[model samples]
Target: MKLSALLPFARLLCVTTLVAASAAQAQQVLNVYSARHYPSDEILYAGFTKKTGIQVQRVDSDDAGIVARLRAEGAASPADVILMVDAARLWRGESMGLFQPVKSAVLDAAIPATLRGAPDAQGASSWYGFSTRARVVVFDPAKVKREDVDTYEELGDPKNKGKLCLRSGSHPYNLSLFGAVLEHMGEAKTEAWLKGMVANLARDPKGGDTDQIRAVASGECAIAVTNSYYLARLMHSTKPEDLAVADRVQVVFPNQASWGTHVNIAGAAVAKHAPNRAGAIQFLEYLSSAEAQEVFSDANNEWPAAKGVKVNNSALQRMGGSNFKSETIPISAVGGNSLKVQQMLDRVGFK
Candidate 1:
């Protein structure tokens, strides 16, 4: 054979080697579309990379913005994983076919059925809840008795008139809570409850959960509704004002005597058109691990969704929610009820 003839084959081999190298490099990266804006969550991503050697490249936005972006990008999206912080938004994505059904024995074994999206015919889930935050009542003990506002229903009682504070009824957090209320109380009763709550407002529903908690502490209202994690953050804070807020209000896990507290989730899924399908599944499974679950608790004050995972978060312990009975209603059902809940909010003028 001539040297010139061998040169052509050598060039072909070089090009093939470069192509394989490029492919391998691409496989080492995972693109994430995330709705979680917490700075502490950076640790979660870094931990994943440390364990799996897959670098995470993330685009951060709120749940609605992430959903809209995914819809606009469609099949061309580079996202391997989607992390969202609300059950309603996760359901919306699943309903829109934004997430692919994932079948992982690790995920199935670790997460409770009630905390994850409903399984498909093949026993695959569209999304899995990694962490939970309870919708709890915060009241000024000086003004309101614990028994008077212990349950979600009692917050609407005429006895509590002109003493309740809340964020917008249409917010996803409230929508999920209201949806759970509807699941327990039915349409007519839920609407009546909303009207009662409206009649009892200390002021128009304004501000975030923490603000509502502060309002209670400042004596702007005798009672307010907030997520447990928000309370936990205040409980865990070092700042004097936050500590004062935590001390002034009493926390109640609503409906402990009934179906249990209304808990919502921060969940993740594999993007429907994920460019790195295996990497996406790996990331989802990592989120179900005990280490990751602990971060969700200690760093963000959320409860672990994984079964049997224990957290050392003092804030969670201080809040006395360690053993509270969380409602067993399927998260899918709560998401399903969001639209109706929003309508009821409007009809009752619960802005």
Candidate 2:
């Protein structure tokens, strides 16, 4: 065919190619393998996309399942980020080499140094905690006076024997608390505390933090151990009975006179083979921003890891007004010592 006759077809081909290229560029997505099952997380993801035009796709699973899937996928994994509900899970993922060291000034400046893991040789961090929850005490004011249960060590007092309620010893929340105690009080003291605390249980260790709160409300136990956020959830519930439970219990920030409250975290790490590295980092930084922090803290009844962000939950407000000191021990230390803490719990028969 003559040049003039072929010109229109050639032009059509170039236009199609350009359109395909543009579509590919516009289709940027960040895949998140998340162990956090909170419905509120949708708002954070949507807000990130609205700001940056990068879509987020999430696969929700238990921490172990998420880790196993990532390992199975290896370098070809589609996960751009790993969002977890506990420091131990994040630490486990990093230790297993599932995360890449991420460097973000926003993350570094907004999050406390202890919340983010220590920097590697090149000054990048493998994981960052965006929200925190204190493992605290809840007591029936009718049965236990506030001043009488001021510290964690007080829970083991003989006067409180047969009046304490707890979740299973194997739960990560309790494990991390035990880990911190081990870090501060050493093996012998922690072992002794565990023995006494176990002996004090009103019933066999059972249920989640929420169950412990309910037990306190019913006066089945005069005192219980639970995450601060769980009490926040109870206080904020639309159901009247849940609110009643909140009213029945008085909040206590344990160990305030000594080490401060023990805290665990909800955190994220960039997948080692993220397909959209820039978008992943941008999303991670967005999660660290003050706006996202508030949303997360309010939704989960947790505290923001970002400096200067306020805790908006009423339960938290009633407890300490957002300015109480938390334990200053590095969170990584708690995560690292988790195994030993579990072993001690098992040995002490903290069922």
Off by over 4 Å in 1: 1-11
RMSD of 2: 2.9
Model 1 Cα shift for residue 149 (angstroms) = 0.9
Deviating ranges (above 4 Å) for candidate 2: 1-27
Lowest summed lDDT window (length 10), candidate 2: 312-321
Go through the candidates in order and give the C-alpha RMSD of each one to the true structure: 1.3, 2.9
Distance from true position, residue 196, model 1, in Å? 0.8
lDDT of 1 by residue, 1-351 (tens): 999999999999999999999988989999999999898899999999999999999999988798888899999999999999889989999999999999999999999999889899999999999999989999999999999998999988999999999999999999999999999999999999999999999898888999999999999999999889999989888899999999999998888889999999999999999999999999999999998999999899999999999868998888884689989999999998989998888898888
Q: Write the per-residue lDDT of candidate 2 for residues 67-182, one digit (tens) a residue.
A: 89998999999899999987777777888999999988888889888898768998799999999988888899888898878888878787889999999988888878888888
Residue pairs clashing in model 1 are none
TM-score of 2: 0.92
